[model samples]
Target: MSKSILFIELNPGMESTGAKALRICKNMGILTYVVTSDKSFYDSSLGNPLNDAEKVYEHRTDLYHIIDLVEYIKKLNTTHQFRAVTSLSELYVEQAAFISKALGIKNHNYEAIKLARSKYAWRDFLRNKGYAMPKFIFIKDINGLAYVPDEIGFPCVIKPVDGAASVAVSVCDNLNELNVAYEELINYPGFGRGITLNKLAIVEEYLEGDVYSAEYVVYKHESYCLGFTDRIISGYPYFAETGAGFPAKLLNEKKSKFYIESIINIMNFDNCILHIEFIEEKNGDIQIIDLNPRLCGALIAPMIYEATGIDPIKTLIEILIGDEPNLKRTKNRYCESRYVGAQCCGKLIEVKGFQQENLKVG
Candidate 1:
């Protein structure tokens, strides 16, 4: 039987885990079909791999938005019979889950993925389950922002319920600041990739502390840890993750792992790869600050492989195709990534790839 798979929102290159998985699939001889935005697929500045992959994958990708992808895939599957349908992009993961169900492919529950997509809904679910989370309230519209619940108080964070990459995330200490954040968040149109915005704002109590991620590769009935990544967070109230180091240099490793797993088991997420980010509070309480259903982004896959020798991207792909994944850690090393950002936001004219020969510690 021929192996085939559907990848949704596969960002062309950018060292993303999705891009890495696409390369792996092509190498494995899987007929790959992608549904992604034109902006990412054709951008050469990010080293567009699709230019070459289009020939190897046995299909030429046309510019298709997320809205038309589902129906189009359904029609195409009549002939292709895709074995797996998945995406690591926040904009399309939920849709991909639904497509998997629609195609009778084994994947996570669509509702679970949906819940994960909306920060407000996810937070509400956690609260109802008696999970320890910071105080929060959901604002349906600009009118709703005026009634900021007193229970949450000031010094809280406000962000789009369906946001990613800290697009409109902000911290507000008073009503004036709250209005500013709400305005900024609500004005942003959509979550990119042509997907509709959730249009809901979530105001959460500010979590003050050190940040780290509890990375896992759940195979079969057991969850495996690839080790935590110590996060270097900056951008003030924006909380942009500027850098990270694998095998987080911290004490009480066992306790933190146990605490994080307990929360994961409760969420009952069925994705093969689980990347949950948490904050070790100033007062010593560990709480899950963000839960991402995909691999840890920011080019974290290389770090995981360098430190643990476990290929998380391949592991996820295997699990999606109903195969057992390898979770063995073959190496004990340290790897870290530091991101460079422009001082002012502007349209990308181009991006220069790093030269390996000239690389040095800053």
Candidate 2:
């Protein structure tokens, strides 16, 4: 019997996880249906990327844009059956949960996703559950900072309650910087004066440390450790991640252990995927930074596969489809990702060299 699966917002075919999913489904002969808002996502990027078995379903539904996706998924369910749904898009994780519940498919709960997406809510949840986290303030009003102590002060980071790719993230040195960051955050892309944006901005004491990310698979209420990666950042004041490399070569071994246990304890996972960020201080104390219930971008999945010979994405998908996945590590190798940085701010011309090297495409 052939299995059916739905993938949401599979874009820019060069995306590692997306490409892997497409390849896997195609190879397994799964009746794959790829969905995205833009029909061009199929034609322009995903076109002929996978084998003929995988089918593309284009709809004008921005899965992350809220209402449209929910309605569209409901509409799609009336006509087609989806056994599982997967995507690397962090923004659509909740919507996927909603759709899964609506269609009676295997997936995490909407409440779980809500807790996963919102930094302020997740922090409070962790603290309430007796888990350790950084000192944080959820800012509903920009003026609320005036009452807070300045020592919690400059060099702190402010970010939206629910955002991805470090978008609208800013590090404030003082009151003036914080104020400017606040204004810029409110006007950020993909956010508006609505329920989504009003959840609150998180102001946290900047935990100084080497940045790293953990990728894991949550199955049967237990989280399986995949591996860790070092985050590469670019820009200033609001340094967004350029890429990631695996395995994380942190100076301290205990710090990596702390990251894994702390993340598992906080996320309360049972059959899911988690991408967590952490900072390791000079004193070797590890602090959790941010958490997402999805895959990290910049080809970290493939990187992890190269490093540990463990594919977290496959395990995640297997769990999503109600299949027991093997979580054991097979082999280990060192892997790194080089960000394709532009020398000058100009239109992207073309890329080369992939055809010659054994480098994994996407």
Candidate 3:
């Protein structure tokens, strides 16, 4: 009998990471049921980009939708008997954990998942572990705005505690600018809609340095530093990431070793895949920005495989499903996926060279 896997996601459909997962599962001889939140997920142009896969399911991106999917999956397990449940989407990580725990399957500890998902929680965890983190406070609201100095003064950053794709992250140089930034964030399209701003926001003393992300594979309580990559983020007041490239030509062996050791020790991570952000200041001090417990969505793993032949996604799944992840660096090929930024000009225009091979267009 073939083993089954349950996947939940909020993306339009199987983008690059999803496609990678699909390919790996097929090769491993495991049956996969790809679950999305809605039919619109498959309706968008990005929905069927791969156009190669034969089996995938689309549901709505909603709580009720996911709950129903879980129920259906549970029923199927009695008949099909799945081996594991996992997710690559940030929003569904905790949900996946809950499902796996309920099913008595292999998964990351729920506490580890929570810490990885929340920026504020992860910062506090690292700080408490004696890891160097920027001075920060979690604010419930603008109440007592005058007391900002008591925590951290001007030149601070305001970002949602649980946010990705660099959404609503702003750097404020002064008091008035901070207020304006907050307002802008509250008014962003997804705010108060997808997630509640009233929950909490983090105010932190901004550290100046070159930003980079360290990608690691933590299997059976051992952390393997596959590689680090330079994160390209737009400058303040808005810090949206544009892309990432692997083999982080910026870091030498010593610097890489220091970051890897620090992350492993501070996070106390066990048997998980992680993506962490760090700032290497001019004085050679390293400060952590945040970390995520899933595969970094910007195709960082594939880029690393392209550049250095180390695939983090494949390795992570193998760990989750009880298979040993291949930790070999196969080839030195630099892979990069650039998001073509477009404005609200109109409907559609001509896109050139997208059909070329070796390019994963989402």
Winner by TM-score = 1
lDDT (Cα, tens digit) per residue for candidate 3, span 1-362: 87677776534445557667767777878777755544344455445623433345554434435566577667767976767777787767767776777778865466678677788888888778776677888777777345667679988988887777677788888888878777766666652213334346788898888898878888777778877778878767888777777767553557756666666756666777878787877776677787777777766766777776767777776787788888887786665556556656786657777577656555
Off by over 4 Å in 2: 41-75, 148-151, 191-199, 250-259, 262-266, 348-362
Q: Among all windows of ten consecutive residues in candidate 2, which has the lowest summed lDDT?
A: 190-199
**lDDT: which candidate is best?**
1
lDDT-wise, the better of 1 and 2 is 1
Global lDDT of model 3: 0.70
Task: For candidate 2, write residues 1-362 as lDDT tens digits.
Answer: 56777876553554457767767766666677766655443444345443332566655444345566667667765665677766667766766676677666655556778787888888898789877777788888877777445536667888988777787788887888888888888876552212134436888887766788777777776666677788887756776677777887666766566656665665566677778888878876677788787876667877777677777667666776678987767777878777676668888667678778867544
Q: What TM-score does each of the candidates earn?
A: 0.88, 0.84, 0.85
lDDT of 1 by residue, 1-362 (tens): 76777776665455667777877877877767666555354466547655434332322222233345566778878978888888777666777887787777765657777777788888888889887788888899887767675768878889887777778888888888888878877778754445555568888888778888888876654668888889998866677878999988546677777877766667676646878888886555687777777777766888888888888888887887777887778999998888777889888686555465566433
- Off-target runs (Cα >4 Å) in candidate 3 are 46-73, 191-198, 250-252, 255-259, 335-344, 351-362
lDDT of 3 at 5: 72
Off by over 4 Å in 1: 12-14, 37-41, 52-68, 344-362
At residue 100, give the lDDT of candidate 3: 76
- Which of 1 and 2 is ahead in TM-score? 1
Q: Ten residues in a row with the worst lDDT in model 3?
A: 190-199
lDDT of each: 0.74, 0.70, 0.70
Ranking by lDDT: 1, 3, 2
